[model samples]
Every structure is written in C-alpha cells, then in structure tokens.
Target: MGLLFILLLGVAIHWASAAKLGVVQTEGGQVKGKNVKVSLLFRSVDVFKGVPFADVPGMWEKPKPHPGWDGVMRADTYRDRCLQVTLLQKKTRGSEDCLYLNIFVPQGRKLSTNLPVMVYLYGGAFLLGASNDMSFLGVSLYDGKEMADRGGVIVVTVNYRVGPLGFLSSGDARLPGNYALWDQHAAISWVRRNIAGFGGNPDNITLFGQSAGAASVSFQMLSPHSKGLFRRAISQGGVALSPWALQKNPMALTKKIAMKVGCWRMNEDVMIKCLKMSDPVKLTMAGKIDVLLILGKGTVMDLIEFSPVIDGDFIPDEPSKLFHNAAEFDFMAGVNSMDGHIFAGVDVPSINSKTANTTVKSVRGLLAGLTKEKGGAAVESAFSVYSSNWGSHPDPAVIKKTVADIETDFLFLVPTQIALQLHANNASGARTFSYLFSMKTRIPGFPSWVQAEHAEELQYLFGKPFSMPLIYFPRHRDLSKYMIAYWTNFARTGDPSIGESSVPAVWPAFTENRRVYLDINHKISKTSVSSDLRSYYVSYWTETYSLLPSTRQTGVLRAGDLSPPRGRPESSARET
Candidate 1:
C-alpha cells in the first residue's frame, strides 16, 4: 500500500509538470516548450526555446532547413549563442552551431491560430548577440512571453551567425559572405512554412530588428530573395544607409583573415577549403578584428571590419542606388535621440572631463582617419555646422552631447532620415512612419544627461516595465503599454493607431515634402513635432559637406545636405 501511494504521488507530479508545458508539431517533428506566465494580468505563453530552424552551415555556405526530427525534440532550453566577443572585449563565448529560433505562443483553450507573427533579429554591430532571453548582460534580451501575451501575437526570435564566421566574404563567387543574412532568410522561410502549426498566421508575419538586425531587415526589403516572405518591416537604430552597414573592399578584409588563419593561397578554392577547416576561435580572434591592415583605411568603409557585401545576388547594387524603390510593405524606423552616444562617447573624455576643450581639433584628428584627404576640411565644415552655437566654453555635458551629436547624425540620425525619405518617395501608397525616441533610459550606466541612448527603446517596447514593476514607475508601464499597442497594431494592420485609443496622438505618415516625424517622449503628440524635420541639419550635410571636394575625392556618398546643422537648426542645435 505504501509503494502504491508513492507511485501515485510520482504520477501526480508528472501530470502537474505536463500541465505547465505545451507541445506543438512542426514540419521537423514534435517539440515541447515551457509554459511561462507574464504581465500583471497573468497570461500563460508556451515558449519553445532552441528549436532548430536550419541545419549547421558549412563555411561560407548558405543555410539549409533543419531535417525533420525523428520524435519529440525537447526544446525547453535556449541554444548556444553564435560565436562573438563581449562588448567590453573582456570575454568570448558561443559556438558555430548556433542557428536556432525561439517561438512564443499565447496559450488558450483551443488552437491559437490566425495571430500575427513577429520575428525578431538582434543586433551587436553584426559582431555579437543571441536570441535567448538570458543573453545580454544576463538579462532578458529576447524574451517574447510578455510581447506575445500583451500583443496577442506569435513572437519568434532568431540566432544568426556573427563575426568572421558569419560575414567574411571573398568579394566573389568563391566566398560571397553574408552567411548571416542567409541564416536569417532560412529562419524566416521556415517560419512562413511552419508557423501555422504553432497557431500563427504564416501570411501576416512582420520582421523587425535593432542595429545590425535592422540593417538586415532593410536589406531583405530590397533583395529579390526575400520577396513574398514578410508583410511589414521595422528598423531601429541602424539601416543599410549607415556607414558601417556594408563592407567596402571586402576582398582585402577577407584576404587579411585568410592570412591570419594560415589559409592564404594563390588558388581561391584551396584558400576557402583551408579556412573552412581552420579553428573558429583563431579565426575570430584574428586580433583587433574590428579594423586592421586593410586597403580602405582612413575611410568610412573601414569603420566596421566585416559586414554584408554586394555580391551581385543578395545585394545587387549599392544601398543608396537601390533606395529608389522598395518592397510593397509598410515600414517604420527610428533612432534614439542620443543614438551616437556609444560611438562618440569613446572619443570624448566622458562626463568626468569637466574642463575639456570641445573644439574642432578634438574631433579633427578622428575625422582625418575616417574622411582621409579631406579630414581637416571636413572637420572645419562639419564643425561649422555641429558646433555653431557652442560658446567655446560650453559645459562638459553640453560638450559631450555635441560630440555625440556628430556621430549621431553621421551614423544614425541622417541615415535614418534619408532612408525614411527614400522609402516615402519609393512607396506608391505604402506607409512609412519615422520617429525620434527621446525617452530617457532608467538603466543606471548611462550619464543622466544622455537622453534615449541607443537601444533604450527596446526595454519599453518589449514590456520590461511589466516584468520588473518595482524597478519602473507607473509612467513607464503606461508608456510601455502604448508602445506595444502601436508596434503590434502596425504588425496587424500596417497602422500604429487603428481604433487604439491608448495612443496619445495620430502618427502622421512621413513624406518628401512635409518630412513629418514624431518626437516620442513624456508627451507623445503631433503638436510636439517639427513639420520640416531636421531641415537645417539636412541642408548642412546634404548640401555643404556632400558637394565638397573631399567627399568626392574620398568616394564617399553625399551623406550630408546643405543644412548647416546635421538635422536641426543652428538656433536649436550646437552645430551651425
């Protein structure tokens, strides 16, 4: 009798565990997932972690769909991250076999079908990141439980290759890089085909990402290979138009890596074969891999060591040339008000430098390296625009913001503005919404003076306030709720405000003439926005800097307009 009671207890425990988990059949086979509870409202979501969407890829080869599994593949755990170095450059972790996707489905009595699907791609300058919830800084970087629950959509996060393993290309057929992009393509294709089994609408999938992921989404919007794959697209903080998005003279960078891996040879086939078999760790650590001995030195092309290549197929032309037309899909993109903080902060003496000189000389040395022959002239011209209003002895905070403003405009602000304008002009009627995320972050690392530094919007957009209620104020929760509504509403009907009264104001569609853009902050309203939208800075970069002889000689794009300031008027900004 005692043994029978013990056996009954064991069965009961197993039943309870099963009740908290869910099973779904995929094209590959059956898989089990964890049932997670989210939000104060207490909704359950089945989160399938580390489900293989594509098989392990060979070096420089496109990915293939995962072979059908034999039986119920236990997918309750996150997969290994793709190989990458940490942001601090203090540590390294991950593996070559890291191509997996995590899917989150809102649990219900019957099948949860016909729900909109959102597939996310993370960004780390195309160098590092993972799809696991506990990925970045040991926090929930890619958790979709709350998003799936709150938005009533199927949320899928993907793990694509980064670093040399993902982006090193030979600039030819031998090794046309962008293996990471292909991995993204495979993951999306798999989702389009198999998401119905997970109770999602395969037809209404929205692809969105931040940083490199955003650039990847923009690339897909132009690539023929990605046609008919997604209905809506969103990019945050990065795009193909950014200086670091495409790897110019990739052949030179590839050859450098080849030599580092001891794979150099006269024959391209032999060189590639050796690289395939070389140690991945050694290849990744090709030391200072961010930009070393390369032909495109002293130019914007060398900003990032490895990135997507225009291999004639995936990206047939330069991104600027291709922006004349785009996919027939609604689009949304924005940048943090201080999006350049991370990049420009490294050069400036930081908040600690109380009496530092915020002059052209401080930035001239760096611009010389990036702008090459025209570095000095470029600095003078840009300084005239960027530091126009600074009274030479500006406060350190103001100085820091001014420095960050240059990077913000060059790397993110202007590029995003141009992208929105191009998409607006290209679209027949497809809508494009642009915004500037000015909401400050609650995360403590950033100096209080910094407003909406890069990726600050992610936490609010992903419902972080809902998860860590104690750490956030009531205002954060309210802001997060409205953001989710706008994002999900856009995914569902291509409009952020369609009967959603929670939104503070009507988001006007950006056009070439009006150039309307939302300034998202404590008060979210059209009345708070500028109609001309960075008109002065637009003229400074596009007209003054772009037409300069330096820009022409450097072979860089006409990145700036005639506006004295990068995006705002001299009276409003530090730059003239």
Candidate 2:
C-alpha cells in the first residue's frame, strides 16, 4: 500500500510539471509554447501568445478589448511576420493587423524570480522587417533549461508598422503621424503592464536596436513620451543624429507619395479612405520605389511628410540637439567595420563616386545650419580626407573597401560616437560602451568580399546559424555560441563580459579619455580601433561645417519674405 501511494504521488507530480511548462488555455484557442528555449547557445526563454497589452481596434478605429482565448496556445512556431512590400519584389502579403511581440527568457532554476528584460527593435531601414525573422529567434540566447541551471534574464522582440503606412507624417493637425513609433510605444507599455506574468522585471527593461531600429531607439531616448520606457539603450550601426535618421519634412513627402497613388489633394480622411480602397498590391506597384530610396531617403523626410519628424509632440527636437543637451540614459553605440561594404561591390570608381557625392551633399546640408562657409569647407575637407584614405590602396577592391570604410565612419560611426560623447560629457551616470564587429564568416556561396557584411550578425545571434544562406558555411555552431554568450550577457547585466568563456579579454568601455572598444572577429579582443577615422570626422563636423542653419543644412530652401513660405530648390540635383 505504501509503494502504491508513492507511485501515485510521482505520477501526479510529473503531470503537473508538464502542464506548467507546456501550453496554457486562453480565450482564443489551444496554444503551446516553450517556457524557456535554447537560442544562440545561451539559456534563454521565450513565451508566445501570452496576452495583448492594449485593446484591439477595428478598421474604423473602434476600440475592443481582446477576446481572451480558449484552451492552451501553442507558441512553438513564430507568428507570421508583419506584412511588407519588398522593394526588390512584389505580390507579398502584409497585414495591417500585424502587431505582435515575442519574449525570450534566460534559463534558471527559480522560475518565479524577476529577471532583467531586453527589448529588441529590428532594423530594415524602417521599411522592412519583423520580430519573427530567423536571425532574431533568440532561442539560444535564453534557453529555459540552461537559464534555470545557471541564472536567467528575459528577452522581448517587437514588430512595428513600417514604410509609408507607419512613418508618413503630415504637418497638418488632422493626421496622427509616426504610427510606427507609436506601435513601439504601445509594445513597451504592454511589457510594463504584463511582463511580470512571464517573470520579467518591468522596471529593468533595456531597449536595444540595430540599423533603422537603432535610430528608432535613439528617438525614444530623446522623446519625452519614452523618457522612462527603458532604463538602458543599445544602438548598433544606426544613430538618430545622422542626416539619414528622420525626414526633414515628412508631410510634404507623404503628399508626394499620396499623389503618386492618385490620392493627391485629398484630405487626411479622404487619403485614408483612398488608401484603404486601393488594393495593397496595386498601391505598392504604383510607386517606383527602390530599396535604397525606401531605406535611405525615407528616413530623412518630415515627421508628417513621410518619415519620423520633429513633431512638437512625439519628437520635440532634432536628435543631434537632443544629444548635445546631454539627455540622460545608459547607452551602447557602435558600427560595423565594413558597414558600407555591403553597398559597395566589385564596381569601385562608379560606386565610390556615387557614395562620395551623396555623402558630400549630405555633410554640406547638415552643416548649412551653422554657416555656409564653414559647411562648404567641412564638406570639402571630408571629401579630401576620404579620397586620401582610399588613394593609398592600389587594388580596386581594396580601394572600394577603404572608401566604404571611410564613408561608414563619416555617416554612421562618427555620429554615434559623437552622441555617446555628448551624453557622457553631460555626466548622465549612463555608461557608454562601444564595439566593432569584424568577424569574417567562412560561409560558402557567400561573397568572400562581403566579410562581416550588414545583417551577418543576425544569424549567429538568433541561434539560427544553420538557416538559409548561413547554412552554406562551416563553423556555424562555433560562431553562434560566441555570439549568443555575448548578446545574452549584455541583455542581463548591461555589460557583455563573459568570464567563463574561452574568448579573450574583457570588452573595454568607452570612457572619457581611453575610448576602449571590442573588436569582434574570429576571436574577440579589446583595441583602440577607428580613433584616427573618428578624429577626422569630428574635425569636419565641428570646424568646417558648424556654421549652416538647420533649415538650410536639411535642404529646406527658404525664399525671402515672399518666397512661398519655404525656399525653392537651389539646384535640380536629386535631394537625398
């Protein structure tokens, strides 16, 4: 009788444990999700179909509470990515109702303890991306079992509206612009309210992003609305201070896009109606949208025009000015060693000319707010420096590489560094950390010239190294493990140091004098990288180009008293 009783108790315990770790019923339907999953070689966790943070809204903007689900929800498979119209392709399905968030929790024994939360914002130049991309799976970063065995943290990835629908802003009071940013805000609010149910500490949320996502993160730091949304921030490759961050006049641009789709002269109400009436496929096709234009130029327009803007509300001032004021926040910002190489291929001179010219124009425009003389000189100096750096390389490929590297520094890296410096100088208690990802992948069929190319880190960090193009390579597991450890550690402690790893030396912080950085290669190491390049960039920005007025710098030609309120174009050249 005693043996039988013991056996019955053991069976009951096993069933209860399985139920707790598996699927749970909701108002919707049956759902199952891993309590904690291994992603990117780290013991992190993920929970899907948990709960919606906000009430659902109907097509006409009628608010409705989310109808709870029935049975357990299986969160094993990723929800479908948000709808996007790929610039290179068409006929893709994207839905307007695609707002979702995924969570990754670190493995740990005490399941009920609160854990640090890292919220990731993805980047596709603010035009294309979703939280479900294989590169961002994050299972390896927070495998539940492993996190339980060791200590744990929580990871959250969110999807925001992208492209014209999300960013288009009209200066007109009728339009509520920056919907994409609003989506992000909503996601954060959701995290604050409900993350504790999944063992996440709402007070310890860290916001991080790459590329356009990074730019968005920067904007959040500057925005009063996002003042307390996150305690720390990590921006990779994209900084909001850059000329390419937000559109100068988004409302005007949105009108242009609207006209292209036969919605010209329409009021906000009519415009939305027309947009909804048109087929999504047809609407995407009417615009001669190139990937570069969609990604690069889109970010520069006005908040109401077509991009994130200096709205008196959501975004109060330019990111540069905001950073200069030394806005308080913990930050980690850096750029890839070959950030521009992704755009520069075998064509050397042609590509170099295009890139250099565009950069010169942008630099000139940015500095116009200060003084014309200074802005022109700054542009000239920047071009001269870039040319000299590339002139040393005899090989076209090498020359292209050099030019790309210089451009990356001028456009992305320096701006990020400057923001960090400004923040640090203000004595904001927020520490600034920097890193350079230079690890070259040995993946076959992948371009050998494209070492550590844009978006390469996504695969290893997501623990999906064997997925798609990355699977063609050898040593995927090795690389994935290293990436997982670094990212997870950063998510946990706001520092990426891994003491137990075979990897070399601790990554240095970007302090006042000694600007230490981590060079992530085949093996990670600490080094004083890109100092010379950064110095040149700073000189150009401060001395040569600090004279132009903000409106002029952004190419907003203001005519004299009667000149149509704003100035006409000075030249017929393509802006942006």
Candidate 3:
C-alpha cells in the first residue's frame, strides 16, 4: 500500500510539470515548444524555435504570411538560416526558403499581466547572420532564452533575406531593391497579428537591432508601410543617414553581378529570369568577389556593397525627408565607443603624422572612390576640416585617433546624432533617448583597450555565456541585467529607466538644446553630448545640406556651393 501511494504521487508530479510546459494555440495552429532551463534564476521557459513567419514562394520576391499547419507543429529546434557567407568567410548550411522566427515565452507569469513583445533583428552588414545559428554570435551574443526568462517579456528573433538575392535592382521595375526590408515588414506584421496567442501584448511591441539591422529599424521608421506595427524602436550603431545604409547606384552593382554570373547578355526580363534560375551559391560567390575587389582598392566602398535602395514604394524619399513623417513613438538610439573599428580594417596600419601629405593623400584617395564627380568638392572640404583638427602634423597616435574619430563620425556617430535630433525635433510628446555604450569588454584576442566594439552590448543584453571569468568581469553580468531591464521596460512602457530592474542611474530624455546622452559604463551617468564633435560633424551633415537628390532645386545646395565655412556659411561634409 505504501509503494502504490508513492508511485501515484510521482505520476501526479510528472503530469503537473507537463501541464506547466505544454502546448500553446497560435493563430495558425497549435505548437508544442521544448522546456528549456534558462540559467539559474529562471529555471524552465517554453521556447518555440523555427516558427514560420512568412512563406517564400521564390527568390527575389516579397514574402507573404505563412500558411500555417493544421495539426500541432513541433517547434523544438531552429530551422535553416538564410543563405549567406559566414564570419569565417566560408559558406554555411542555409536555404532561400528561410523566413522563420523564434518565440520565447517566460514561464510562471501571471495571467492578468500580458508580457510585452521585443523583436530582435541580427546584423551582418545585410550579408550574413541567422536567428538560431550558434556558429554566428549567440554563444557570446543574442541568447533569447535568458532574455525572455529574466526580463519577463516575450523575445523574438527573426531571419530575413540578405545579399544579392535580397537587394538586386535593375533601375526599372523588372527587379526592384528592398525585398529584404519587405521581409522584415512581413515578419513584424505576423508578430502583430499572431503574438497575442503566445501570451504577448502585440500592441506593445518594440523593434531593436544592431548594425545593418539597426539601419533597417531606422528605415522602417521612415517607411509608410511599417507605421503602427511596433510602438517603439531602438537602433544600435547604425542609422539611415549612415552612408552604407543606402545604396548609391544599385543598378551598377547589379550589372556587375550579372556580368560575373554570365547573365549580362540577356534582356532585362530574361536576365532576371536567368538570375532566378541560377545557383544561389554562385550568386553569393559573385557578390563576395566583387566586394573583395572594392575593399582591396582601399576605398570608401569597403563599408557596404549591397543594401536597401530608395525604392519608390518602400523607401519613397530621401531618409532625411522621410524622418520628418515618421510615426510618433518612443526612440532609443546609440553607438559604441570603438564603433570605428568596424570600418577600420583588421590590419589597420598606424598613420604616421610625420607624413602629413601622405596622410592627406591617402584619405583623399579613400573618399574619392565613393562619391560622384560633383562630390569631389565635398571630399576636399572634408579633408581640410580633418587636417585642421589634427593640426597639420602631430603624433602618430594623434593621427590614428583622428582617423578613427572621422570614421566613427562619418559612419555611425554623426548620423545617429542627427537621427536623434530629428526625432526629438518632430515630436508629438513621444520622448527620445540616446546612449553611448562605453563598457570595456574582454572578448578573446582583442586588446584590453577595446571599449565595446560594434554590437558588444548585444552579448550582455541577451545573456550570452561568459567568455572571460565571471570573477574578473562581474560588473558585465550586472550590466547585462541592467540592459535587459532598460530594453524590456521600454517595451512595456515608453521610458526605459521606468522598468522592473534597479538601474545604476536615472536616464534622462534626449533634448536638442541640452544635448544630454546617458553614458553606460560600469557606473551609468548622464553626460553632455560632445559639443565640439557634434558642432563640427553633426552640424555639417544636418544643418548645412543633404547629399540626397532634392525635389526642390533652389533649396538643395549644389556642388559649387561647398565653400569654406569660416568666411562663408557651411562648407564641409563627411564620407561613406
């Protein structure tokens, strides 16, 4: 009788555990996720991996809502990643039919309070990345399990198209660009319509991304199609104003790819058809070859090869003009301290200030490769400003630092500041926040001086396992909690600091007048924006004139108008 009683108790406990980690009914059908043990604090969380967000009928076409299954779908493991070259410069296992998303719901949440949704878009310069592939960056960046469990929010990771298959344009309507952005839009729409069933508040969704993904967030804010899908946004280390975010001459690059793939001789329609039929591997290889050629030339083209174009439907106008008409919602945008390291090649040679003329010449050569004929004057003016800032001939370290500064401002900082300013200026009580991630990380093989390289904050925010000893980097673990708090809190409410966790400092809203940004280090603090840097670079980019094609001939500054700023109005500009 005692043995039978003990057996019955054990069976009851097993059934109770099963009920806690059981199936959920989504809009399409029922899904059974795996019971995952996420870290120490939050033991068991149900993670639905590789859930199809959209249906891919073919390559180079817009994605549609997924035709979900009839019966229960087992979502235990991640699906295939979208095809792209890996960080190691080798091809990995992926497919063109890859428009899936991962949904993670925290366990033990009360039924009354529905959790907010946070969608993550990974970044690889629009060339490579995956939602579930640990070979990419998840081991030390973007762990969804920890984010969902600890933050008490539904975290989603999405996979979208990239490379030539995603951004090919033919100057006409035969093959338009921005198919990748369209994929993102579809994914967001899916989340909005179906996330409620997964214990998420679809109305209170936040879109957050880094690098190329960050640029996409900025673009979505500007585009009319994505309005009202998500309530808040966070762009890290990239923005629409960044030179690499928008492709200058998409057709020219498309032609180069076609020529390499032996489809150049065909008519526009035939060429596109041939491209569709061609091997995905060949297309990816061709793109990589051309990109290497562009990078090897030591030109500004090193930053990007293929990216979102100004398609009339999706990205109707110049990014600056579109920023004025963006949806009124809370925004948080920022960059890392060492973001320039992304643009500066791995083997960046120290620029010796002793060779002032050589330094100027090299800089000119790099800028000249990326601009149009009319843009020469802009490049020359930019050179003059940099030379003045560096004081003709200074120390080698000074030259190196100045170069990194210019790269940072041109690629990330200036653009990010301008975006924040625009969002703040055109406000309908929707607050704007800016931050600078300056925490020093100890990623293996990198120098100790490395202060948060691009996307380093992702590791802490998503709870990647530690690369270094926790004893040595205890503050980073603490910081991870703080960042997740800020992000998930912002998703729940508009303000990040008004969330669940205890933050180290009070984060203030960004105002154009005060120009205050939260500096997130070991100890967070609100500090003054860089007056000299902002005045020099941001003013030049935002206040002077736009580089985009203008609708009004008189309002747009011509190439001849780029004169010296001291005696005249505005003269200098930066590069890609």
Best by lDDT: 1
Query: Tens digits of per-residue lDDT for model 2 on 186-284?
Result: 788777766776667888787878878888888887777876677778887877775467786666676666677888754667876675565544554
Q: Rank the candidates by lDDT, best first.
A: 1, 3, 2
Query: Candidate 3 clashing pairs?
Result: none
The top-ranked prediction according to TM-score is 1
Instruction: State TM-scores per candidate.
Output: 0.89, 0.74, 0.85
- The whole-model lDDT of each prediction reads 0.75, 0.56, 0.70
Poorest 10 consecutive residues of model 1 by lDDT?
Answer: 556-565
What residue runs in model 3 are displaced by over 4 Å at the alpha carbon? 1-21, 39-43, 88-92, 109-113, 134-140, 289-292, 295-300, 346-348, 351-380, 387-393, 444-450, 465-472, 526-533, 543-576
Can you write out model 3's per-residue Cα lDDT over 298-389, one digit (the tens) per residue? Answer: 44435367798888889897777786556387889998876875455332433422333235555665545433333566567666666665
Deviation of model 3 at 165, angstroms: 1.4
lDDT of 2 at 270: 81
Better of 2 and 3 by TM-score: 3
Task: Report the Cα lDDT for candidate 2.
Answer: 0.56
